[model samples]
Target chain A: MKKLFLPFLIILLLTSCRHRLVPMIGMDSNGDEVIEHVSAVNFKSSSADVMNLVAKDTLTTLSNHKFNSGWDMNHFQVGLLINTTVGPLAWKVSATPGFRLVFKKVKK
Target chain B: MKSIILIISLITSATLFASSTLPTDWYQPSFDKGANQNTLSTPSAQADEEIDHLFSTQHKTLKRLNKNANKKWKVTDYVFMLALSKSGLLGFKALNGKSVFQVYYQKKKATPVKVEESKPIDIFVHEDMTDSDLQAQIEPVLGALVATKKIDRNTTLSGDIVERINSVKQVVGNLEASTDKKFYLSAFRIDLGINSSGILLPSWAAHKGTEVVLRLQWTRIVKKGAPKALAYKSKVNSNFQAFTESVLKDLNKIDESPLASTGKKAVKVRIGMGVTTTDAIIISSAKTTFMGNLIFKRNKKYKPSKSVVTNDYQYVIDKSIDGAKKMGQISNERFIKGLNKAVKMGGYFVRKADNSKKWKVSMLRAWYILSVQGFMGLAPITATSEIELFYK
Candidate 1:
């Protein structure tokens, strides 16, 4: 039982804490590249900080007419993974401003 | 830090109270507790049924026809299609002040069946797929056709074929000719698949309960002598396969994520992002992707001009920032690292009819991924300033 402990611990570490590369892109808006709105949600019962990274800049810019704006988009479509989190502190810690936004284009 | 926490709590409480009158489940949160409320997941029951029907019917039939050599082979035309449902609403993400992703599907046309045209055709289901592996699964379709006397063993087969591999097919190398007929094998063994738009995100698969189809079309072949036929018919468009533009990056650009180098046409880029409501289990946001043609343009000078150049790509707000690197400059540095000489010449992502225009350097890629979480669990967030630039 003692010998198996080391081996099992190593195996668990190997499988559980592996890093994954998600196919993410720069969702850089054309204008207003600042943190238009930012809020942090902490669940007292669960003890997790879910920082809301809300940049509601794209909505006002897109053409409202469906045909011209993006005739192609007609649904809410995004990829989902079972056991993956976004960042280093994703779903784990309650750090201040889980992410720091430095918008080079936006004037402070 | 205390101020930040207090501010967050204050805002959250106020927002909760504002929507207090609504039902608790109205804006349900928490991934484990409920089904994903995103656009892709809501009508999933209908999506699942439609997808199953397609697989059971059209896909099965295509596999069957690829087998039984006795059955007449129509000219192969494969199409890839993505459709978006007019939902009750695109949940919170689509409805909020955020743009969404677009899904493109290959158009389905009424196939013209030539009843008296007894010309037998042998569909070479791309050189990559093995006959034995697929034969058994779709055998029933052919068996039913033959049993009903739709086609017989003695029917003359037209050796004429159409390969529906996605890339632009060009017959490059050797040719072996029979006394009456001639056969020419294409040079590159192009392997590709269906995609999320042009982005090969995953295997362009249909979720368990939704419908997305990759279809192959067979065209009527006009047999004009061997030499003339070989001269005119170089390659046919095989629109959609199981893999796509991004998967090609699987073996080579193993480090590159979100983008798979699926097709070998030219150096192209697919930019996308996602947003969700309650569950991360189900995709609650559209993979809003856009294909930008960088390398392969009929007009060479106009290609990848702005997307790769740093100066031309600055957004209006870009200059005011103290130390902001231009999106183009970032894209240039990262993309140049992965791009080889070939994509420098070939890979170009363009619209079906508008491959002539010069590529633009815009901050927003038409679709915006907006992630907003309220009412359950730790709320959601959305950010996309880091793009994984992939090349082949």
Candidate 2:
């Protein structure tokens, strides 16, 4: 029972491991999930300021049909996928305003 | 600075740990009603919303595209014509404007009919058409309006009915032999005009305007009713003929020409009959030929100076008959005679005969082609025919 428990714990830890972060920045015209913009960006850290700014710009341009002095950011599914085949490193995030960043978190 | 760095690192670690366990609750203003709370959904509702937004945003662009398509349809409005014949017929295009599409129909399919768009079409049934057959041919086109309904089916033709259509007789082409040339009498001249008219007159107050003129060059073969064959001694000579001219002289001036010397200066208009050559086969075998041209002119304007118009028109008639066949049956012969008779008959309705001029009967050069079928003894047969006209 102890050995079975250890294997289950390992599986859970592996599934929960942090791999990458992506920042998506664009919005649907009606505040829908559909992303509408010229392009988007990807990032490893949610804290990446550049990713957020680009995402915001993309959303602002798409919804309002004009670029904003400040960045416009809206959250959308974009093309996000999390399943059995793809590892965490395969995760991608994208933003518009002409920027994309792909990075994997340093595994602890 | 050290404390601040440690604080940021701790915050990052905690955030990562949270994300690894569960993704962020993505901001969706559209879901304020808790519409998509439990499941991570790429909702179909979201796709519809995006499409609706696009339509609303580019509303003007799509509207213009629709308008352009409609305008294109207007130019080609006359996609079909319901009634047609050698003389004329009424055509209605459900989509056309006020313009009458004048399409010229050929007896043979080889001839091209001219279609005039944007002109008020003059609808006419040849005078020879029996009231019954005319109705049959026209009923389907007119939505059976003539027969099925109680509405007035009266139609005033463009020119006087050239001739009542005789289903028994076929119209002919006789630009060839002199006698065969004289059949087409001068129909009314059509002066094509652009939109609208010059006057609005009450039906009661009558007035006269300067006469609009027309000319015809045709040939006629003198036949005692209908000829059976191309024989030289065919009863053609028994028909009395007149080659008349209508000269519209000033009602107030003294007559100048020899026709006026007889104390009548009114322009002389007369209809005559004569003959020229028959078909080549007939001419080769017989002692005589069967043809003549019936020249119809505005006698008042006939002069030597305007001969250029004469030359050009003669050229047109000559070129028109290069490959036409020679002989046909009585149907073609009668039509030519009927057309000539209609001119004389219809002209009397418009003006009085001026009894004051010396008249001359002469023939002109032209050709003929046989056309149409004559119904005889319950069988329809083609007739020998000719077409002729006068220039100047």
Candidate 3:
């Protein structure tokens, strides 16, 4: 029985070594996964003078990849941004036919 | 002394067996020990639970990834096919719409052993030659070539021929009639032929199941309201067949794609004018606004490009039929001019809905009609149409 146990243990060890898991990750300066959050705001004035009081407030919120709504009765576009360990993704306002007002996270 | 020896032997064997098999119970320590024994023949309950949870998460993640991949493939394929169709039509039109002919000859078992193309071949009609004489002349030459295996005995030719002819004649009893010129069209003759003497194979065998050959001939002709026998002379260009086969190959690839799936949901978009009124004054007491909304919907597994998604909150107007009707028309030239100015300003615009129009609208009213005729960054669609309304 003792002789048989030694052979079985050796076979089990060989089989277990073949199925080891390898981790897939990247090494940055800190050797950790990188993730960031972003928020941006957009404000604009109405040339027609319909909502003049809030236009300045609207302009303050506008930034790269972020938008925020201004006061009520005001024409403004606002958004929240999220950046992750993966590639950057954007969601933004379509003010013109071909352009997007986008917002992104600040580098940590 | 013998009885004492027997008792000792039993006690020794029991200890060896007890060490070999661990107890099967829920206690953690006992379960762990049992896991290492070959004869215990049971797994720990916790291990089963861990494996189950791991597999469940993996299954769910794989499902989501598959769906996302499939959706992307569907959208890309639809766009690709639309592009290919346009490309194929444009390529053919630029070439003066010339017809192509291909021939294949088979020496053994109707297999096209040799294939060739005759492109841009001129069709000559011997006006004075009798139909029987023309046929007799061509048949002998063709037969001789086949007999010598110079041309495959099983060569097939197919093509389309378009032509128009006019002639002047004298009338026997009265004046010749004035009329439009007559037209004569020859149907292309396509066939599969093998040149047993050479190694070139027919286009049919090259394209395999992707293409079908069509053969047309000029069996009869009408000239000046009289029925006349038709005769045709054909010149062959061998390269045209290969060109056509290449085109057909691309078409087959497009058709086999997932975009070819029928009855899938389609994304529909329309751009028109919308007019509205506001209380704020620009240069006068009240402002009259005429604007366009680039209204859209993703419509089941469809997502619009980010540039086309109207993020200007004003464009999300409340549901109203009157508002929708106003969306159907512009106020006047004043409103249209003002709207165009706003468009030039680059901020997205939205229209307001009145009470009467908003209440009677249908669920289809969920979609907004874009005001501009040409929207940039617009993806190719599987189907598209436009509607124009009259003032009446």
Best by TM-score: 1
lDDT of 2 at B322: 20
Model 1 Cα displacement at B119 (Å)? 44
lDDT of 2 by residue, B308-391 (tens): 211110001111122344432232233333233222222221121122122111111112221222111000001112322221
Best by lDDT: 2
lDDT, candidates in the order shown: 0.21, 0.22, 0.21
Candidate 3 lDDT over B48-88, as tens digits, reads 33223322322222222211221111100000000101111
Candidate with the larger DockQ of 1 and 3? 1
DockQ of each model against the real complex? 0.01, 0.01, 0.01
Model 1 scores a TM of 0.17
Report the C-alpha displacement of residue B334, candidate 2, in angstroms: 32
Question: lDDT of candidate 3 vs native?
Answer: 0.21
Tens digits of per-residue lDDT for model 1, B106-191:
11222332111111222223323333533542244344434655344222211111222221222211122111211111112211
Off by over 4 Å in 2: A1-108, B1-131, B141-392
User: What ranking of all candidate models by lDDT puts the best one first?
Assistant: 2, 1, 3
The sequence of per-residue lDDT tens digits that candidate 1 reaches over residues A1-108 is: 999999999998876444211111111233211111111121111111111111111221221434343233221111111111234433322212111111112123
> i-RMS, every candidate?
20.2, 31.4, 30.8
